[model samples]
Target chain A: MSSLPDRRLLESWQDPKAAPYVRIERLTKKFGDVYAVDDVSLNIFQGEFFSLLGSSGCGKSTLLRLLAGLEYPTSGRIHIDGVDVTDVPPYSRPVNMMFQSYALFPHMTVEQNIDFGLRQDRLPRRERAERIGEMLDLLKITPLRKRRPDQLSGGQRQRVALARSLAKHPKLLLLDEPLGALDKRLRENTQFELVNLQERLGTTFVTVTHDQEEAMTMSSRIAIMEAGQIMQIDTPTAIYEFPNCRFVAEFIGSVNLFEGKIVERQGDQVLIEAQFGGLMRMRSFQPHAIGTPVMVAIRPEKMRLCETPGGDGVNRLQGIVEDIAYLGDVSIYRIRTGSGLLAEMTLTNIQPRTEQALTWEQEAVIEWSPTSGVVLTE
Target chain B: MKRRSWPLLSILVFGYAFLYVPILLLILYSFNESRLVTVWSGFSLKWYGELLHNRQLLDAAWLSVRIAALNASVAVVLGTLAANALVRHGRFRGRTGLELLLTAPLVMPDVIIGLSLLLLFVTLQQTVGWPDGRGFSTITIAHITFSLAYVAVVVRSRLARMDVSLEEAAMDLGARPLTVYLRITLPLIAPALLSGWLLAFTLSLDDLVIASFVSGPGATTLPMVIYSSVRMGVSPQINALATLVVALVAVAVVIAGLSMRRR
Candidate 1:
């Protein structure tokens, strides 16, 4: 986790001179009439843990399969490490995939499963054994090397699948929901381990996942996809803090969106006359013309209990607390304002739960700073 | 524990008796000293000893075993290939027609199959001047033609139920298509192939009508010999042969069961 900050500084995508390791050019895959992966182009920098985040049926897995050469693009080309491989089959590509189902060979032991790829490359017996041993140790399954897939637990099978995929030391590894099959506790622990392994090996990883927290925790950059098109691609921090569009903002996490029109703009700030009856002064990275319809997206945790309710009504809202959900560390207060808009606010319980001040049906006032949220034009 | 109902117990006993009485009677009579199948005197191994020396029956039995082995081997190969095509190749051209044709023999009466194959062999001999006469080759070919359908059915169901990702994973790990099929797909579906081979062997061994129609004078199968002998009169020697067959099949089944359990 400490290495994350340093890895962020070495972000090759931020540098224009750094060439991409994988370049997909307008890749499109169609199964009959449905476009599984529509015309989409993306460049993944070397040694980066990139994630394709989306709900099911959003074409993320299809895109990953296209990269693995398991599913060829109906049109467009794929270039990996400066070589065209669109026509290459999965076996011939310099890429390996860890399927969502793990897909371990039930007939083979762990050692044999991991040894399969090295054997395919015609490696000598000694070298193959050495590589198998190295992989078993790396995944911490040395003792289970002689066990068949069905004899191992789910987590052990996952490790064996990971070891097998990494045996070849492919230039790029595609993972389709790599941690989707694990229990919740194991999934969280493996997420960090995966990131650390990626950094240590410096092998570019492209994983597809529907878990936003998993994506945010492990990915150096997250690509949000919807309906076979990428909605946003940026660092996890940027994707969370400053989503480029309404779809991206709502998709990543819970956000309270206020539909409004921009009535004033001064430098990097814009004043939007919100539909909830008050004006919202928000920081905007992009310029918005006056009278342009937009949305002010603010996360629930950013909203706080207003200290001085009557001082200024610019970013303040007075409402009745309609619902209070006590969630151990924090409490969610659903405030229904006079305009009949439900604004959700999350407050950390700094004190004991019994000493909390807010309650259901109580009149509460919430306010957010201008920089705490973003204004999206689309 | 619940008490067993008298009615259910009687029905169970009746079912068992109905199925096993004839077999039990035959086994008992096989050891009788008397030559009459229905009459019993003292227990003896004379019929078993006489069966060993019966030249015609021995020759027919050997011919039947050879034809069964050859038919099962050839059917398994062709049938497994057919199953692979139907399962792995997703909706290729003429798939429906091919599937229908493959299963047609399963429902076709043995008489129809025998007559049609006999006609086909005659026409082939007249037109191409091949298959010159019907005997061992003709009988084995006829058996394989019908046995293939049963083998295909068994293998196809197993192949369909298999996890397809195993093969895909192999290919992903850099195995070529042929290597993937050989290393991953074949090993996983081996139990199905074994069962299919055994099924075809039994079908070929049990066949009577088809063998009679296709076989010329010399290639008399065991079933044909047993049926002709029964037409004359029930022979104690045939009972001894039947008992041996049942024992061999039971042993084979036990071996297969044990091996499967170990896996």
Candidate 2:
């Protein structure tokens, strides 16, 4: 896990004067009539592990390809280290990409694959061998150096591809769904390994992945994209906790939303006339006038279920437990409120033996603090 | 396992016999001591000895080998380039027309291709005053032109199946287009190129009608010699020559099959 203290230290984006290492301004890539990347602009600072998180056809991969110079943007500009590289070809760019499929050369041995880039530059024989040896040792692929890609397992091949890309020591590295091919356990293990490697090397790493958890776990900042456009860009925690819009809030994690119109505004606290015939009180630092239409969103983990309503002033609802899912670490109770809206509440299993604590059809009170929910206008 | 069906087994047996029995009989009688065709009085190596001493047949066989080897090598090179252009370079001018021209020779009748090529060669010799005599060079050129089409098809299919990202990855690692082609594209498609070359070699060696049209005096190929000899009479020497060709082909095919299986 990335420690909170280091996160704060690495939060250089908060500084207004911090220089961006890579700047993409109004970039657009069109294939025939379809825009793969439509006027997307972003700034990535030096040494930041950034991610473009989106599903298929969302243009995240296309954005990364544009940065790698694998694709030419139909319009706008790309700047890396203060140099404009919009028209630069892939081979001429000071960037490298690790393809999702690994794309290891079937005919070449692992060592030869790693040495290919070095050989292209016509490096000295001794230096090339040294760099290849260093990469093999770093990636723990020294034993498989003599084996061709066909002879290696999937994981071994992945490491060979990584070593081949990293051996060149490019200014930036772009990874396109790097761990999408791995199984669950290997993907998780490799995710952390990749983050640690990027940290150790201090190279600017920009990865594109559809997996939300992978993006959250690996990147310092993430850009959420949809339909060839970026919807939001922020730190993972900020994006999860204080999403600027409904799509960001919903895309990052599951949320219990109360569609409503604002009824009262008292400082940071606001009362909403929810659509489900309930008056919901929520608090936010963002200012909103009375009679504003909004949706109040609270994460499932933020909501709690109790046998009886609490005495404290908090949002509460009477509901029947429609579904109970025991997910080992936590139990999710789907509560169907009296107003016919289903709200999910997650409770951590502190006691392992409490399997039947909340049974189906049992009446329960779902409650949450005023500050736990964020209001979404979109 | 269940018992095999008798009907299917008989069909398989009869099919193999129908295909191989005549060839086997011809091979067996190639060692006949009798000079008369189809009369196998005794097993002997006299016909093979006579074939070794036949200077004209031997010369023609050598010429055919040289032509076929050149045809396969040149076709492989040209076909690889054409395949790369077709598969990698997207939407070039006259792409459809180029594709149709390349594949036309594959389906065209051999006599038609041979006749057309002969006419073109004679016209070129009259107008451009080059290739003055139609012999080994003209025949080799004709074989290469047709053989390249088959090679291009094989290499194109191989290039299509190949992941394009492999070449992109190479380029991302600072390789120029030419370097990427040499290091990545060529090696990945090497198997297709090899098989294409072997096919071209075999086709060139086996061609009779096309070589007869393109060939001139002092450049008679093995197929032309064999065809002329068979027309005159079915001699024991002809049987021996046919057996030698069959052995050569069978060995090449077996080797190719084994290599494919190993891969």
Candidate 3:
């Protein structure tokens, strides 16, 4: 081999109007009787950072493995850049995967590991050497190029694995829990670096992670999976603020649910005779039949607290402070109403605005703006 | 220490002496001048000088070296493949049965293996016309079959203890399957392969029964020559050859030990 390819080699190879980056149709993986990745069809836009987010056993990793061509789908079609690749072996796919464990080749130094794919391509020796140098500089790991994986720290090993993966100049990159092995601070820092690097290189990344926060911060859009099915596919804010069901409502973030029956309905709002104690007025874009049982989902941060009922908002209820929790930046107050209502209020630490804090057993009023809550018809 | 530990230590020590004493005695008597067996007169290097002149023993020794070298290299490759399959691939239907069959050669008696292979060669000649007669070729095949079991055992344990995610990470990093095996898997288990080859070499060199059953008229391995010579009383030349064998073995063992320690 001559050498590794330089930056210009890869930059000049980029082509537009080539093909659809990846089109997955009804991809399903079955482990005996269990559907690990159910009949799922999705289109990955070119150069998009897509995330598969869910808890463990939700089959997010399985879907990613399918896309990486590590595991074949039982019955489905996979096309990469418009080529049918359902039966293509992982090595033949124009995709590379970064494992959750950040598997760096231990026997070789960092540079050799990154140069592995280029060597496989039988590239000219000069190009291989140049590409290796360029990747080392691009990944900011030139200083550690000669070190074995064991000598490098967790984050450095991750970067080496990434450099090696990207050195192949793959059209797609599959990240399996990329930041899971790092400390919290390192994870936060590396997440931004990964995003910026992906943007700079413009490789379509399909990341699989159980960390909701990491997905929220890194991905352009996330597929919220549950029990081998996607519950919602949207941006992080949309998934959090307007969950389509009770499961999505609770899984993504904390929600205060009031199970109630809608007794009155207006043009765009309704009055819910809550199962707890009072009537709650909620904004409903969803069609709700009167006298039908429903649930109102409200985030604690959206709720405002006071010692007296002075809200112009229609959804107001009086309750006694059952417990007061003083967190560092914010305080959480658990208030109880008649007929078993446990309402939570999160108060920001604005010292001069001492009006929000409450004492135990103190009677208080909790209110939320009508539009801040969602009404789940089911 | 436990009450059983003292007895265990003594047994191990005594076992070491039992194993070493004969080799030590053989080396000492290689210098004998009396010419009477077991009755040492004084020490001399006359037998060593005589051993340098024995062309038949020297040729057999050379043949033995060639056989061991070929067997070890072939066995290491085959054994590493078998070991990877047994470790990396999970249990499917008939896998347990395959494992049982794979390991049967390890504990089977050498005489049975020798006789069965001889029979197999005869059957192949009578039916298939391949390997028309048994000789060095058949002997090496027989040795490869039995020695491969030893090599596979070592490679298997090394592979089983290996972290599997290492290979997965390589694949995830854009390595083709064969490249992952060659670059990552082979390098990681290289120590195991080295020791396995060494083991197969020693076993082929030390073998007598199987080589005897399979050798043709002209194919005289060292152990076959030594076994035939042992029926006659002790010879000065045999002692000289034994001493040389002892020295070569000791040096090889020391090299192996040093390599293992460094690793």
Candidate 4:
């Protein structure tokens, strides 16, 4: 408490441009004997849309709570700008948390609920009215001002909640699965709306979600957490393309993994005799010995299927067609190799059902270029 | 096995008839012209006119109403506080025992509560010389002793049914605890608080045994006057008074029901 500089508090105190809008350093939280967040550190530049993506019970929400000052760290410090505010209470901190349940005041009208925080700060009557009006307009919930939370639809309540949280315009905005309560279609649309709003306000937004696609679509950078630790932190493309472990690769997207050993290395590309697929290769940044074991992660769409099948450059494997799935706009084929291993090949519809489709038990070939397969060393 | 419910309905109807027919009969007899009780000579308003002229009975009714109103106000305030303390505040030592003790008035016989309160007041007066005498104040104390139990039960149920997150959400949004309770919690539970108060008021109004025990010479209440009239033998005026009392209760029930329904 004495030496820690709280970044949010400091941002509220200083000019917003001078500091990263949110900073969390070595923040750890414990629930009973289980460490919920173990020494997590991150910095979000002002106006950046950051996301904490993880599986359930991965402590993503806990980390978000620490950032919002809803919960305190067991051991480290939080700084909003450059000042230490590790011990600052949530109300006094310059951050607002939108709860997953929306946590709207049920007895109040939409206008009164949005005005709750400003009224608590003893804002002048006229100024509070203007701010509330601006927020309702910004979220486009002006017509719902007189309705209670239960009367409005889920999307409407969600907008009212967003308006309420943005009423104060704190330097950092923490969203705890903001789109989770909406229906699927509404959630997708609200995600874009949320991104646009954050862009317009230029406020640092920290979102916590278990839905990987939501995180990927909205986040500038994602910190993938698992079991109280942040496994990797990178841009969405980097995380998807260059996962450090099988967990990150599998968690972020559907990837076909084949166990293999590095038989030869040519700079960044490694050639391997995969036990399951019989000769696979990948380009990996992590150095490996000539005989070291690794995992090859290939996305479904990346694997190419050929009827004639005479290719040898990077990751070419021979398999028989075990099954075909005709999904809309695309067809996925399960290719069974000589080793009886299944590799998935997803074909986007370039033609009708004839050219790109395969029958069960038909002999086929599944392959991809070297850059498509990613090596997961850990 | 599917059993017909008409038998159970028949029993309930018989039970209600057993309980209410005599009261209805008294209400009808209040309009009789005969001075003799139990004989319906003709429909008239003579006894009602006589009841209005009975100054002692009127004074006693006023005294009873005053006592019940005062006792109900005190009970509701004290009960609301106790209910909140019991439910919201965390556990402490003797909590289970305290809860049991709080329910003693509700389960204990009215005679016992009346006797114990009278004894406690007399002892306190003798020891501290503060009360000096027991009359209206004593009866009010007795009414509150029993009514507080009802108030606590009602308010505790309301608090239990309440969504506690409303308060926590208020605090998170920057309202202080006192402000949260005032602006959110009190309004949400107001319906319960009102019903609790009205129940306590009615209980105080209807009490006979406890009030009889606690009353001194000047504190004779309406029920005591009515009982004395009944003991003296049924009279036309007493039936008329009973009808008036039944009307008052009916009105109170209607108002209380309307209040609850509005909520």
What's the residue-level lDDT of A45 in candidate 2? 90
Which order, best to worst by DockQ? 1, 2, 4, 3
Name the best candidate (by TM-score): 1
Shift of residue A108 alpha carbon in model 4, Å: 3.0
By summed lDDT, the worst window of 10 consecutive residues in model 3 chain B runs over B254-263
Interface RMSD, model 3, angstroms? 2.3
Q: Give lDDT tens digits, candidate 1, residues A1-378.
A: 255435455569889889989999999999999998889999999988999999999999999988988888899999999999999999999999999999998888999999999999999999999999999989899999999988998888889999999999999999989999999999999998999889788899999999999999999899999999999999999999999999999998899999999999988999999998999999987868899999999999999998776866998889999999899999999999999999999999999988988988999999999999999888
Higher-scoring candidate on DockQ, 1 or 2: 1
Model 4 alpha-carbon drift over 4 Å, by segment: A1-19, A34-36, A262-264, A289-293, A306-314, A338-340, B1-26, B31-37, B41-48, B90-94, B115-119, B122-133, B142-146, B212-217, B234-263
Instruction: Report the lDDT tens digits of candidate 2 across residue range B138-182.
Output: 999999999999999988998999999999999998899888988
> Residue-wise lDDT of candidate 4 within B83-192, one digit each (tens)?
88898986877778868867998899999988888788888988998466878998998888778878889889988877775665566677777898999888877877
Docking class of 1: medium
Cα lDDT tens digits, model 3, B171-247, are 65556788888888888888888888888999999899999988888889999898898898778778889888878
What are the models' TM-scores? Answer: 0.97, 0.94, 0.85, 0.85
What DockQ do you compute for every candidate structure?
A: 0.79, 0.77, 0.41, 0.42
Error of 3 at A170 (Å): 2.6
Q: Which model, 2 or 4, shows the larger DockQ? A: 2
Off by over 4 Å in 3: A1-21, A310-314, A317-322, A352-357, A361-363, B1-45, B84-97, B122-134, B159-185, B216-219, B227-240, B250-263
